[model samples]
Target: MLFAFSIAPAGTPGDSVSAAVADAVRVVRESGLPNETTSMFTTIEAETWDEGMDVIKRAVEAVQAHAPRVSLVLKADIRPGHTGQLRSKVERVEAALDEG
Candidate 1:
């Protein structure tokens, strides 16, 4: 499963939300799952829905600690028998571009 999500604190004073975002990313990093953090979202690969959601729940909680409310955007591609799609999916696209 490939779970991509963006979590952040809402209604903060300053324009910067980096501190709260960093906390969420920290939780994902410590999970030992296949993961990547980009400007807009963090993507993680997990074997089951429970495993993936647990990480996201904790990430939301991390951001929630900094503010009264949190905003989360999530997208998932769940394939039961597939693993390592996190990097493999991108590699396949790049390979296709190279071939073209």
Candidate 2:
């Protein structure tokens, strides 16, 4: 199935954002879904901010590890310079999933 997964969060503190992202990864890892893409995304925004970007990267990496066959789609509001940074990561993950 073509799944639309999103991880954008509302305005939140940097730490809380990472925490939320970790939690989401945990949930996905534990959900035991055959296709991770079939599982809905949760609290992805927590992984989007400057402070939270690393956490977001780690979380997505974890997800990729746990569900190597799943596709991931990430959406973010970005200005000119940052237009495709996170989006690039998301696409990379999706490509990896496709390859796997």
Which candidate comes out best when scored by TM-score?
Answer: 1
lDDT of 2 by residue, 22-84 (tens): 555665545432213323454322222553444445556654443323334564454334433
C-alpha RMSD by candidate, in order? 0.5, 14.9
In candidate 2, where is summed lDDT lowest over 10 consecutive residues?
31-40
What do the candidate models score in CA lDDT, each in turn? 0.96, 0.44
Clash tally, candidates in order: 0, 4
Off by over 4 Å in 1: none
Candidate 2 TM-score, C-alpha based: 0.30
User: Model 1: per-residue lDDT, tens digit, 1-100?
Assistant: 9999999899889989999999999999999999999999999999999999999999999999999989999999989999989999999999999999
The per-residue C-alpha lDDT of model 2 at residue 8 equals 34
